[model samples]
Structure formats: C-alpha cells, structure tokens
Target: MPGFRLISFKRCPYVQRCVMILREKNVEYDIEYIDLSDRPDWFNELSPLGKVPVLEVTRDDGTKVVLFESAVINEYLDEVTPGSLLPDDPLERAHSRAWCVFGTALLSDAGDITMARDEETLAGDLERLGKKLDRLEREIDTGPFFLGAEVSLVDAAFVPALQRLAWANEFHPAMAIFEGHPKVARWWAALADRESVVNSAVPDLRQRYEAYVGRDRGGYRSLVGARIAA
Candidate 1:
C-alpha cells in the first residue's frame, strides 16, 4: 500500500472535504497544516496550482507523486479504498460527479455571503445562495445523504459547505439559509454529527471561522459576525 501525506490549510473547506474522505475510508495518513498566507517553499513546489488539499503519494517502490484539486484527490482516495463511494452504474456516477461540482459552487456562495461588504451585497449574495439551495432541495430524492442512506463522495463534497452555512445561520438567523429547504436541511442534519465530518477540521474551528469572517474585515457580514462573536 502506498503511504499518503496531505497538505492542508487550517480553515480551508476544500481541505476539510479531503480529510472527511480520508477518515471515512479509515486511511492512515499524515496531515501537515500550513499557513496559506505564508506558504512554505516545499508546498509551493508540490502544488502546481498553489492550492491546499494536495496529496503526496509515496509508493512502495520509493517513487513519489503529487496530486492536487480536492475532487480529483477524493476520487483517487475512493478508488484506492475497499468499497467505492460512487455508484456501480456509469450514469449514476456521472450524476454524482455533477452534483459534486454544484457543491463547490455552493461553497463559493457561502464564502460570498461571509465577505459581503454592504447590505446590498449581502442581500444579493443571500438571494444567489438561496436559489442554489432551492435547487438542491429539489434534486434530493432521498433524505440524510445526497444519493441515499449510505454516505457517498457527494456527501463528503457537500458537508463542508452545509456545515459552514449552518454556522452562519446560527450566528445570524435572518440568513434563513435552511428555511423552507427541509430536504437540504435534513441532509445537513444527518451528516453534521458523523464522526468524519465532526473531526474533519480543528477542534476550535467555529471560533477560528467566526474570527476569520468577522474580524474587522470591513464587510457587512463581518460586522454581524463580529457582533455575534463579541
């Protein structure tokens, strides 16, 4: 078996997804957290895109290979593990992959909401995010996980965004991110307590997240987050 090393940024949602997959597969690996603002030379050399969640694979033959991008790294991890997180059917697997892309868009929207500079910007961000959530609610046929009862790669992809949105909603209920989106809300509830999801990030992630988004960032959401943190 090849050994793995994951390069991560402490608060990156992308990195969190990789961590969740690693834990779900019960894969033993070493994770090195780096300061994204001051990335080390080794990381710069390993990551072509200069991104987090870079996977370093060391084969038994002593050859090393580097992989970047969360989605690709996740697929690689899933394929190497015992049971597959994707469906056996090709079309079903493609459908899951498409939704995984949607999950990344959702993550981007959540980031926009956190960094909105004014009420107008915040309102627009909320509207865009709400539309995506509505679409997700309709797309989900079954509850708990994205595809069904058992967790899939889709769940690992979506959970980080859902978790962050839930936190923002908690701090500012007016966001109403989950309001009227019962299916998506249920999905979030289901995965929120899973061991892999819970331990995907640092223990003080909430505090760290709040501080990042709210800390004198000059954004309207930051003001709200700052007030709540205080």
Candidate 2:
C-alpha cells in the first residue's frame, strides 16, 4: 500500500464521513486538519473548491492524485482499500447507496434547515427522514449492522449526522426527530461505539454547534440580507 494525505477540518460532517471510511478501510494516511475560519494558504492551492476532505493519494509508482467531495472521496478510498463497505449484489448495493444519498443529500441538509430556524418546514423534514428510517428498520433484521451482520458505507455515511442529531436533541430539546424511532436510536448508539467514530480524528461538535447557532442568530441574518440585495 502507498501513502496518502487527507486535508480535512474538524467540524464538517462531510469531512467526518471521509475520515470514518478511511479508518474503516484500514488505509494509512497522514491527516492535515485545517481550520475553516482561517484556512492555510497551502490548502487553497490544492483544493480550488476550498472544501475539506481532499485526499492526496500517492501511488507506488510516484504518481499523485488529489480528489475532492466527500461522497466521491469515500467511493475512491473504498476502491483502493481492501475491505468492502459497499455490497457486491446489485440490489443491495443500490439500497445501500440510497441511504448514503439520504444521509448526504436529504438528512444532511436538515442541519442547515434547522439552524435556519424554519420550524414550519420541520414537520415535513421529519416525515421524510422518518419514512427512510422506517424502511431501514424493516430492512435490517439480522442484528446490529445495517446490512444484515456487518456495517456498510450506508451506515458510515449517516453516523456523523445522527451524532449531531443526538447532540441537538440533547441540548436544543426541540429537534426531536429520533423520539419515536427505536431502531434508529439503537443503531446510532451502536455506531457511536465504533472505533472510527469514537476516536474521531477531529474536534468536538458541541463547540461548533454553539458557535454556529450564535452566528445563525446574528451573522447569518446579515449575510442572507446582503446576498438578497446583491
């Protein structure tokens, strides 16, 4: 196996997903943690998109590749690594990918929606996420894992979001998406204990949430107003 370097940040859920997948695959890579508020000049040169979780992949033949986007990075890492987080069966693979999309696309957006305090749309958000969980609860009957007996990329992708949900529920006390979902509660708890998640290669989220929410009440308003005017 060759060496790799992961350019990431502490509080980004997208970055967290890449870290978990890399660790789960047992791929050895050097981590370069960046602070979003004051990103290093070097990072900007590498990721023109200015996003975290950019992987600097080095091959044994002295070739290098830099990739971005959390989902694409996870898929790429899985390609080079030994373990298979994604299923081989076409149907199962599709099903797993659905949850991956759910976590990254739909459920992940809920954080921004909630922070925006658009509580009126929260019921609809809960409905959509709940429906997915209802199906997931029914699909996995074999034990603790998402796909029968073992964890899959589907589970890995969602764990970080679920963790933040738990934090929000615990502190905010109003975002109660997990109130009635027993299966999701169980799965979230189990996933938290996973080595990749527990030993998060990043900082705590509560600090970020506090800062984000504070800004949401103040700076977010001004920023939105400025954008609209433009």
Candidate 3:
C-alpha cells in the first residue's frame, strides 16, 4: 500500500543498509523478501542484475522508478526526506561517509575470509577486523549514537556489520577480538539496541548460511560447527 517497495533478502548486508536508512529517514515503504534461488519474474524484469535492496518508487500517477545499490538508495532517501542523515557540514559529512565506507569494506573483507572457512586465515582476518573496530572506537565520540548524540545514516550502515561481526565471534570462539575493545563492544551494543536494527535484523542467518554452504560443490560443516571448531 506504500508508495515504495524494497526488494530485499532478509540476511543481506546491502538490504540491511537500505532498511536502516529507510527507518532512520522515517520513510514508509513495503518490503518484498526475495528467494535468491527462485526470484519473482517481476523483479528480474526490473533489475537485470538480480541484486537485492532494489528500491522501486511508484508515483501516485502510476509512474515507476527503480534504483539498485544501497548507497544510491540511501542518497535518494536523504534527498527526498525532510531530515538529513548526513550533516550539512561538509567535513562532518565526509567523515561520516568515510566511516560508513570503512565499516562496509572491513566487513566485506572479513566475510570473504570467513566464508572460505579456512582454518589458517580466520584468526588473522578476525584480528584485522578487530583492529578496524578499535579504530572506530577511537574515531567516535561519546555516543548514544554514532554522530555524537543522535543516530545517522553512518550509524545505521555500520550497525548491521557489527551485528554480523558479533555473530561471527559468538559462533567462532577464535573471533573473540572485541573483548579487548570495550568501546567497540559498547558501540555495537548501543547500535543493536535501536529499533531499526532490531526490526530490520533477520535471525535465521545460521540456517540460511548452512543451507547455502551445503549447496556448494565442496561441502563443509554447518556454519555453527565450522565456527566452533575453527
């Protein structure tokens, strides 16, 4: 019934990014959860790339607009919404964007290494990720939120990654990296406490990840076991 539709996969980081932005902007939009294996034909027609977090804007007059990529969707929402997520101050905005990009990039790298389930590299990669968290802790001021006193797009963008990182640590005891960084732990805890992060999160990650891994040509143990043993 809403004017916008977000095509998303529940566990996808990119989709989480878009959801976070939409929630922060207080935008009303409908969400369609897509099965990656059996996507709806309509979605394929709209986005040939077949990626999730696609934003479809339908005007009252029946015009349709589609956008792919979480960053683009976030920018679009910021423009359309009355309140700004990125500050008007150029320097602050740049710093905020830098933090978002940094969190995403670090998490992506960590995911790649973790997904391999390699016994040797998992520890090292997790350590590197922990270092990034340490940096974030150093960068941020005292916060109930990321930009000092309030939640912003940067806070939303990074929170899901922190959630995943925590999951990684919980599943894989070897990734107890944040234990040393109290600030990082507090930041993550605070971020996770938000309504948007809570509402947007998908709790079936371990099962989905297990199924996805099972489908691979080279089979591995359940993600839970792999993490426990790794």
The numbered model that scores best in TM-score is 1
Better of 2 and 3 by lDDT: 3
Per-candidate clashes, comma-separated: 0, 0, 0
lDDT of each: 0.90, 0.72, 0.74
Local accuracy of candidate 2 as per-residue lDDT tens digits, 1-230: 76789887877777778888878888787988888889888998999699887988888998988999878888888887887888898897887887788777535545653454345555666566667666666665655767757877887788777786676566545556576667777788779879988755555565665555445354443222222223
lDDT of 1 at 117: 65
Better of 1 and 3 by TM-score: 1
Give me the displacement of residue 224 in model 3, in angstroms.
5.3
- The Cα RMSD in angstroms, rounded to one decimal, for candidate 1 relative to the true structure is 1.4
lDDT of 3 by residue, 162-196 (tens): 77677666766656757777777777888886778
Error of 2 at 89 (Å): 1.5
Worst 10 residues of 2 by lDDT: 221-230
Query: In model 1, which runs have C-alpha deviations exceeding 4 angstroms?
Result: 218-223
TM-score of each: 0.96, 0.82, 0.86
Over 4 Å off, model 3: 203-217, 222-230
Q: Write the per-residue lDDT of candidate 1 for residues 1-230, one digit (tens) a residue.
A: 79999998889899999999999999999999999999899888889999998999999999999999999999999999999999999999999999999999999998888777677888999999999999999999877689988999999999889998998888778898999999999999899999999999999888888888877653334635655666
> How should the candidates be ordered by TM-score, best one leading?
1, 3, 2
Quantify how close model 3 is to the true structure by its C-alpha RMSD in Å.
Answer: 2.8
